[model samples]
Target: MMWGSSEEYKAMFVEETNFYNRIILGWFLPPMMWENLPHFFQTWLRNYIGGVFLYLVSGFLWCFVIYYWKRNLYIPKDCIPTRKAMLMQICVAMKAMPWYTLLPTFSEYVIESGGTRCFPRINDIGVPAYVGYLLIYLLIVEFGIYWAHRELHDIKPLYKYLHSIHHIYNKQNTLSPFAGLAFHPLDGILQAIPHFFALFVVPIHFTTHIALIFLEALWTANIHDCIHGKIWPIMGAGYHTIHHTTYRHNYGHYTLLMDWMFGTLRDPTVDNDEPKKVC
Candidate 1:
């Protein structure tokens, strides 16, 4: 058995996420409120409520450190987003937060219900094989996300209805870490679908998968901050800033390899001579 028995392993997701759930369950909510709701809704709420604090805490802390204490060092003159823009970013993200979280919550339910290929322990596959599977899983996710993100632009209605919400902060003057997740609800979830897609095809560790989903919150905050890390392979804020500006190049997510492969890559070091394509 994965844990002592099927029953024990099945409860693992709840056990892992419950500390955050207790914030809702222990204080403003009673057990009765949760017991009465559908299981899917309950899990989604746990993720959504916990995610609100996670997004705000990490986003604000990054803002305080990079946008506030060291403003001149990170942001250029006139590039600092106005307070109104910051509030708009936060509001857009808050509105989409629930749907952004729902996919992973559903993935966890599928895994716990014995519907995915995910294993609960590294030892189940041994250290060597665990590392191999992890590398493969990461690559699949990177490849899948690049295409998912790019297609969101290439497709007409998808770009017009969903992706355009995020493109609002297309300039450095308008972009901030808060703009990281200021995507339309469906738009964000569609980009994140690759994470769930990896589960059925790869031997990902169950807990590790969930942790990575949460980590993306912090990461999106990084890439949208507009301060390039200048590391090759990794698609930093500089390249992402160009993506917002031109809407035609640098559609890769996480890595530049896909952009390089598909001929959409642009170097921020060079003046953007590429035509700004419109839908």
Candidate 2:
């Protein structure tokens, strides 16, 4: 099995003292406090509490950056949500918290067969192999999310009943980082299926798994933040803002690869030349 040892697996979840890793991990659990707990308790806290914390912090950071630091520089003034809509988005996200917490536990059960290799540590495999696994995992998630997201729009019943809740923020001004998870519970679950499924099909390192989860949170916020611009082929707020404006296009999560391949990719640059349309 490409997955490493139990000891190596456990090491990835343990608290670290390095400043960079500590800062990243600290966003989930306080080093001075939670790190002192027993390894079992620490690991449990990191998985459950940390997962929720990452979600909240990622949303808040994007909100803070756009609302405070960048002001109207990066994000268009028209695209900024009203305080009421922002508050409502937060309320909807809070309702999804239980689902977020349960996701990890559900994933554990799904991938737990025999000695389970879903949580390999960094040293368990060579760097090249580790990077390759991450790339594969991302491709798998992208393919899954593209079709699921596209169908969420194509299927009228699913769109009206489930996906439509997300479209409430369809226009730019109503969009926010919190709006990313403001989806109906069923809609959120469908988009997340690939993450869990990958655990069974791929030899993912536990650290990479956690990192991907964090990136998903960050990217979700980035897409909804309304900061217009393309990061090359990688979809950003510009790409997603267009999706909100024109519901029929740009359904891929992180990249336009699937959208381009499937003919769903609309040219966002044309809209960029036009005057800003704020909600």
Candidate 3:
């Protein structure tokens, strides 16, 4: 909470010292304030401002490389995506900004506390802390994201209005990551729980938390976007592309373990049963 119209956010981000982390918890601050605002305000402001921030920073960098460096920007021809369309996706995601920010914070905290030290949040959590706090935090974040994502699908009315826009991308690309944020306002709130709950539930360090957030965003954005064929010869982005090809298959967000355990994984080698056009 850093910029709510209420006294709450202002005090934390602007009024308080070390406003970013101490008050709002670093990366977690912007989304929280965006979420807490009145729904109407959140919709317009969050999409326009937040979306532009994300798109411009990323787009400008990519455009720079493409234009100046003369490197081929790998966009799938079939994807038929445009800069404008991708930017619009940012507005689509604005609805889910709050939860997107908040829940991941909790997940990061738990992971940094040594939950899933196996994955390791770089060196920030430290080897010792990771070993001590790995399992519980990892399980909590995994289950939280899995079910939250699943619920978004199973709940029909909710999915039709909120989650459907994400599925609209027939072919995934840099724009693919923006797909998930098009949730209903209510769906956005639901997604925020994992982080808020983790705040009180888990004991975590700040650096570990920041590392976790970066990892989450990186993994997610990479899987959904940059990985076109496969990072590795045998296995890589193809695994996630299969999930996009058949939305029902890949529900787990972080690790591939959950989908394996639940038997929900769709093998990249297998032909899709009935591939639907991107809605």
Candidate 4:
């Protein structure tokens, strides 16, 4: 009968779906390599390999803009922290490497769980699934990081040891962007822990993960250089500069939601006139 034949086809489709899920984790790595490798040869090749490559390319652009053009690239060397703060920033960035290493494994987990939907083949899942996955993943990740950043300041010893290096450059610049990565190893883990939840609970796309890392790094630089101790236009460096000026306010790391919701938003112009301090 026609009805009997249709039922058999449905059963076969379900079997194929389950079988494919088992191999989903394998797809994340190859794509990650393609997106992450080029920068290795530039800034990080000498020491950190990939990292040096990225930094060199980015730093070159940064230096040229500030040095030759005099365009007021947010970070002026004079604003960077001195002695101890600079040392702290360097050490902290080194410590954070272990967590950064875990990203690929986490990405695999997200895909398997249907926590993300930004993969190339995801279009096969239809537009509804793709859009839903993207929205949820972005919200969860942003919220998690915002809270984690806020907590870093609440704890005293940890703030001094791990997070302070970022503040060392009260005036943003190229060097200041990398300062946070030099946090203590523990700080690195703590900072990255939020991603674990997203990896485990969401179905994220491979491209989204790469995009997040790239955006995060670029954001760190932007907030330091572009905002340069001022607040403005919502998403730019101006907003982050307020955080540097008054550590207690502006707790949101990459978004305005947390600061607004948690009552930590600051108006930099109010009390931003003080002489800059070394982190």
Q: lDDT values of the candidates?
A: 0.81, 0.71, 0.50, 0.52
| Shift in Å, residue 86, candidate 4 | 8.0
TM-score to true structure, per model: 0.88, 0.80, 0.60, 0.64
Tens digits of per-residue lDDT for model 1, 245-265: 888888877889889999999
Off by over 4 Å in 1: 1-39, 271-279
- What is the Cα-based lDDT of residue 226 in candidate 4? 40
lDDT of 2: 0.71
Q: How does candidate 2 fare on TM-score? A: 0.80
Task: Write the number of the candidate with greater TM-score, choosing between 1 and 2.
Answer: 1
lDDT of 3 by residue, 43-116 (tens): 33432344335544654454444334643445434543466666676675554565455444344333333332
Return the lDDT, model 4, position 105.
40
Decreasing lDDT order of the candidates: 1, 2, 4, 3
Consecutive 10-residue window with the lowest summed lDDT within model 3: 9-18
Give residue 62's error in model 2 in angstroms: 2.4
Strongest candidate by TM-score: 1
Off by over 4 Å in 3: 1-56, 59-75, 78-80, 95-127, 173-177, 180-182, 185-189, 226-237, 270-279
Q: What is candidate 3's CA lDDT for residue 164?
A: 68
Kindly list the per-residue Cα lDDT of model 4 for residues 218-273, writing each as its tens digit.
Answer: 56656555434434435456666666666777766666776778788765555556
State which candidate, 2 or 3, has the greater TM-score: 2
